[model samples]
Target: MKMVLFLTVSFIIIGFVVVVSMKGKMERKLAFIQENADNHKNATTPIILWIVGTTFWGLVSMALIIGMFFMN
Candidate 1:
């Protein structure tokens, strides 16, 4: 039950971060699109930020799980 709760909270935090980041990215993209209506170029998402964020979260979560397992 403790592990379950930990996983649930970890996922919830990660999910919230993903949602908030995506929302901010989308908003910026929309603003760029609106500003450059003539170009019609595709607004690109920041792949690097997403990659780094995911990697950081994955590492942290794995470390937490491993630590918990060892403690138990």
Candidate 2:
């Protein structure tokens, strides 16, 4: 139980750090897309994938943390 708690907390922290760190890069990508108006094929795939992945993991971590508290 302790290990599970630790892992979930670590995941949440790591995910937060990753999203914050990637903010600048994501912005740059957006800016590039904005400037290049003609090339619109899969221009936002990276940003979409990153957001979906992070959001999914973050929700899973939160669910685990909440479950542990209620189950115990």
Candidate 3:
């Protein structure tokens, strides 16, 4: 529970930092996405997309670890 909470907090902090740092620049990025949504359908093409994917995978892995604690 502690580790999971810690990780959740850490990711929230890190995600905050990423968004804070990219606030203004995100509009351009969104525009790019809108313009190239189909052209860049491949996941690896964008760093933000990769970050999002990794974040999601990390959360899933964390959830699995927590689930193990409940299983046995």
Candidate 4:
């Protein structure tokens, strides 16, 4: 149970950080692209991928925590 709790917390924290950092980077990239006249097509794929990955981790973490609670 302890191990599960630790892993859940770790994953949630890491996922949150990744999501936040990627969002910031995406915002900056969009701003830069707006300022310049460069093609911004397909530029959001990486950000979308990161968000999806982070969301998966977050969901797994939540499920683990919930499972642990039910087990206890």
**Model number with the top TM-score:** 2
Q: What is the C-alpha local distance difference test score of candidate 4? A: 0.76
Cα lDDT tens digits for candidate 3, 1-72: 677667756766776676567656656666777888887655325657646865785686677667757856
With a 3 Å backbone cut-off (N, CA, C), the pairs that clash in candidate 2 are none
- Cα TM-score of candidate 2: 0.83
The per-prediction CA RMSD against the true structure, in angstroms, equals 5.8, 1.4, 5.5, 2.4
Task: Tell me the tens digit of each residue's lDDT in model 1 across 1-72.
Answer: 676767757785877688676877767777877889778554444544665776777777777667666766
Model 1 spans with C-alpha error above 4 angstroms: 44-72
lDDT of 2 by residue, 1-72 (tens): 788788878888988898899989999998999899588768899989988988898789879888888968
Candidate 3 stretches greater than 4 Å from native: 1-45
- What are the TM-scores, per candidate, against the unseen true structure? 0.45, 0.83, 0.38, 0.69
Candidate 1 clashing pairs, residues 3+ apart or interchain:
none
Candidate 1 local Cα displacement, residue 41, angstroms: 4.8
State the lDDT at 39 in candidate 1: 84
What count of clashes does model 4 give?
Answer: 0
- Candidate with the greatest lDDT versus the true structure: 2
Give lDDT for model 1.
0.69
Question: What is candidate 4's lDDT per residue for 1-72, written digit by digit as tens?
Answer: 788788778878877787787788878876776777467766767767776787787788778778887978
Question: How would you order the candidates by TM-score, starting with the best?
Answer: 2, 4, 1, 3
